[model samples]
Target: MIKKLIILAIIVVIAVFIRNSPYSEYLTFSYLEENSDALLAYVSDNRYISIISYVFVYIVVAGLNLPGAAVMSLSGGFLFGAGFGTAFAVTGATLGACIGFLVSRYLLGDVLNTKYEKQLAKFNKELAVNGYLYMLTLRLIPIFPFFVINIVAGLTKLRLFTFFWTSFIGMLPGGFVYVYAGSRLSNIESPKDIFSPGMISAFILFGLLMLVPVVYKKVKGRV
Candidate 1:
């Protein structure tokens, strides 16, 4: 309990520091737009360092459940182009999600399980049966908040490896889409501009496709 508390304290401190820090301003779309030229020049001059730094920052933002991931995704595309940007963003996001998941599991898993034994038990049972499909669907769908899924999955019996892989694969398409859009950042007025109704529908369609196997299995069993 002491250890958990200490860890929780550390997390809180980091989150507070980030929230209050002036550097937080750099996470905005306007900032990225304003400084695109300078930022691009820096990346061009220091390729390896830029990639490393970007990945680290991406991990921190996602792991901490901060608000800059979309901006960072756009920055990635703006700096690295779609192909490399998607790769780095997805890699960082998956790794960061794993960190969030571990933190949640370590801090609140036992307590939550004790408090909501029946509910968690039922959810875990469902996860044990189709955890991958469910996680994948959630990942592909943009409607669900990324951090919420990371935290909730921690409360379940889902394996770490399963969570990591599903998150990586599921986030790939969305990552690519965002990165691609970011490559055209000059034309974007707002982050909201990226997700038109058509784009959202496409994401939903992909998410639903992940459930096809489960639906097929259930129908076959019923027959």
Candidate 2:
């Protein structure tokens, strides 16, 4: 109990620090646009160091559920090209999501389970049956908040491996889009430029496609 409290406290402190830090200000499209030249130069000069630093920052931001993951994905493309950028962004996001999942499970899993036993029982059963499909559908859909998925999944009986692989695979398409956008950072004038209506529609269509199997299974079961 004491240990859990300490972990929770530490998470709170980190969240507060991230919220108040000036560094958070730099995680904006405008900021990246203004300093793209210098950032590119730095990455060019220190390629290995830059990759490590970028991945580390991405992990921290994603793990803490900070608000700059999208920007960071773009920055990865801006700093590296689409190939490396997508790889690094997906890797960092997957690892970061795992951290958030573990933390939520460790801190609040028991409490939530106790409080909502009946609700969680159903949820757990469903997860046990089709956890990966559900996770993939959630990941492919941009409408769902990424951090919320991480935190909520932790409170269930979802396995760590299931969470990790599903998150990685689910986030790949979006990661590629953002990182590719970042690669063309100079052409973008605003966030809207990165995700146009057409692109959003494509993502929504893809997400819905992933749900086909799940829907079919349910229909078949009823039949």
Candidate 3:
């Protein structure tokens, strides 16, 4: 258990260090914007290779909790268009999230469980009861960072299949938002324009609706 926790801690520190270091410069919007067409051209020239490479890289990024996934998602939209981009990006993100989840579950989960057995047990019970609504809320609301969700969800008794499906479906609203924003890249001056206020508002409203059942569950619990 101690060994597992130490390794997990090392991995997270490495991820944070890499993200904060100059190594992550390539992930910035400036870098992406300056080389957009070149990137598009490369992918266009190597379609099958691009898909495989893209998914593989996304999995690595997600699993390791590296930086630039959001930018990568936008790039997916820019290079692949909405339909294909959404499909691939969502698949990649979900798969990557699962990888992160597994790492957390295997490495840190037992330690967390041993340390906080009672609290963790209660939390796991609740998660089993409302994993869908809770995950959907987390996905749509942007209340938490994706990598954090990926790691934190690992410390639970939640089933892997449930985690995958919830993550897939829950991510759709935000995933499509990125894809659509990415698809309009040619017309916009900044990549950030894809997250316009109106669109954000729409997603927030949708998230709130997804939370209805969670709220109901919470109220019932309190009662």
Candidate 4:
């Protein structure tokens, strides 16, 4: 437990250090906007390198809870266009989310949860049973903080594969939405400009619709 805390602390320190360093400048929205044309040209000249770097940075940002992933996803769309952007963003986000999940489980699960293992036995059992569905609902909805979902999920006994896959699929709608908006980068001023009220409603409706089957199963079981 002590070792896990130490390791987690080390990871946080490393992440914070990198974010506060010179690399932080490029991660900003204003900087990206200021150099949009130059960035596009650079991507054109070094397509593969740019793509690799974008994906890697995205993973690291998300894993470390650094700022600007949403903006970065938008930038990816602007640079690579929607299809490639969504693919790369989703892949990196999923991988990064898993990293956060693992960290949470290591720091919170093994130590804290273990302390209350007996007390939490029943809740953990329920989580193990329907954790995927629960996570899916959270993923589909944008109301909650994405990082919070990852870390909270980690504090449970949900299987890593289940967390990874469910998060990947669940986040698809929202992720694609952001990446698609990035496709129209020239027309956008900020990341917040991407999501409109109509879009938020649509996301909520879709999320609820996805819940139908689970609700139906439960109702059927009750009957």
Cα lDDT tens digits for candidate 4, 66-181: 98888888887888888999888988899999999988887767675767667567656656655667678778876679898787778876789988998899988888788888
Look at candidate 4 and give me any clashing residue pairs: none
Better of 2 and 4 by TM-score: 2
Model 2: CA > 4 A from native: none
lDDT of 3: 0.81
Candidate 1 lDDT, 1-223, residue by residue in tens: 9899898999989988997899899989999999999999999999999999999999999999888899989888999999999999999999999999999899978787688789777767767766688788788875669998898889887899999999999999899878988998888899878876776787778768887977886688789
Return whichever of 1 and 3 wins on lDDT: 1
For each of the candidates, the C-alpha root-mean-square deviation to the true structure, in angstroms, is 1.7, 1.6, 2.9, 2.4
What lDDT does each candidate get? 0.88, 0.88, 0.81, 0.83
TM-score of 3: 0.84
Q: In candidate 1, which residue ranges exceed 4 Å CA deviation?
A: 196-198
- Considering summed lDDT, which 10 consecutive residues are worst modelled in model 1? 122-131
**Model 2: lDDT to the true structure:** 0.88
Question: Per-residue lDDT for 82-180 in model 2, tens only?
Answer: 999999999999999999999889987878768878876776777766668878888887566898888878888788999999999999989988998
Over 1-223, each residue of candidate 3 has an lDDT whose tens digit, in order, gives: 6777788788879888878888688766678788988988999899999999888777767778687787777777888998899888888889999988988789877666678778767766777888767777777777778878887788886788988998988888888888787778777677657788898889888888888898898899999
The whole-model C-alpha lDDT of candidate 1 against the native structure comes to 0.88
Q: Residue 110 of candidate 2: its Cα lDDT?
A: 79
